[model samples]
Target: MGRIVRVISKDASVVCSAIDGKDIVSRIEEIHKTSAVVTAALGRLAMGTSLMGFGLKGKDDSITVKMDGDGPTGALICVSDSMGNVKAYVQNPVVELPLNDKGKLDVRGAVGSNGTLSVVKDMGLKEPYCGQVPIVSGEIAEDITNYLAVSEQVPSVCALGVLVNPDLTVNCAGGFLIQLLPFAPESAIDQIEKNINGMESVTKLICGGMTTEAIAMKALEGLEPNVLDDFEVNYRCNCSRERVENALISLGRAELEDLSKDGGTDVECHFCDKKYHFTPEEILGLIKE
Candidate 1:
């Protein structure tokens, strides 16, 4: 099971996750038959979303992370809820790109750096909060970290990792978020920088059998980290036929009439590749209500 760990130290608060998601990402690749490079790009976004999503304080609260870039990967979108459930979809899932200078997946090439990262949070309020920041790097983690620092006015260190195997399945995936509290001292910042500089790759740690808590402990060097919460996260989609039906009804009479000329309408859920069909008779029934 994939697990998200929330912890706190005297100087800071952190969220770390070691998601066992080979099966989940495999299903995603199967759904889209994403190229290895695209899979890495999408997988990193999924990991980053879960780390942010599990921070919602309410049961119905949710967060969406979206990036509109100039690259062929189109837009990357992920929706996550307070319960640690997440779903992801890409506008163009089959983007292919050459490796970067590091001989790693060229995520920045797949998702151009000259774009914007937008975050929307719904907290069961009359109006949700929205923040946008220029894509500092299309590397997922750095972009999100930059978003928090610039848009939210919070200093955060975020790292995300996704390792795609030769067969295009995710081998392991994980991430960690370290936020410096307002009252944190300068020593705390310097200490963390030293720790991070000496630390190893997070996904590699999870691959080598380290738990999320251990990673959290490694992040907080001088301060003692206390595990506050632990829960399972998943690539879960809440889409259903009822939601599709409601959406169809929202199209109004004119749109429904035009759709009826085509005999039927086929709508596919972006989050999950589920397709829903509505016949002309159904459209007529929906418009009447």
Candidate 2:
């Protein structure tokens, strides 16, 4: 199973999370046949959401990651939870782009530099906690790092990457996040920054078969972190046929009757590329209950 590791760096006085999305990301790349741009974008989205999702305390808690981009890739959304379950989809998974000036996947060009990145945390409260920030860079990792620092007031460094082969298959995908603890010393912050700037590419590290815990330890070498927990992360979706039927029933009695006359209804889950078809009788039964 793919794993996510959380560690506390005693020297930097910070908490860090690293993920090797080997299994989950490979499966998604195979299923979507995503273009290079889409692969990079979705890969980063999955990594970022996984970090945030596992930060919650409750098993029932969940987090939603939404990026409304203005380029060919359109919008991207992902949902994840403390259990390390994540599901994500892109509005246009076929968007293609030439490599950027750096000779890398043109994620920014495909996602556009203008948009909003929002995170909603569902902590069993009636109202979810939401934080929104304007996209500083459509490069994903930077955008999310800014969102956490500016919007959430957490000093964080994020690195997310996807390596796609010429054959349009994923070679590797993963991410890492390092955050400073409250009132960390300036020297500690400087050392952490230096470590981040000197670090090797995250994708390369994962492709070399580095585990999540090893990555975290490598990144914070000078910090000497203590591993807190390790969790298995997978691509999981909560949508079901029953949930779709309940939604149709909630459309009201008139809508149910009209659907009965029309035969049935079709509903699609945005988080996963799954379609649920409901018969008129199913809708009526849901409404009666």
**Residue 53 Cα positional deviation in candidate 2, in Å, after optimal superposition:** 0.9
- Model 1, 1-289: lDDT tens per residue? 5777877776444333334444556666877778888887787787777778777799999999999988899998988898667888888888767788998889999989998999999999999999999998899889988998998887888887778888788787787888876787777788789988998987788789887778877888567777878877778889998998899878888998899889988989988888999898877878865
lDDT for every model? 0.81, 0.83
Question: Distance (Å) between predicted and true CA of 7, model 2?
Answer: 1.0
Model 2 regions more than 4 Å off: none
lDDT score of residue 158 within candidate 2? 91
Using lDDT, give the best candidate's number: 2
- Estimate the TM-score of every prediction: 0.94, 0.94
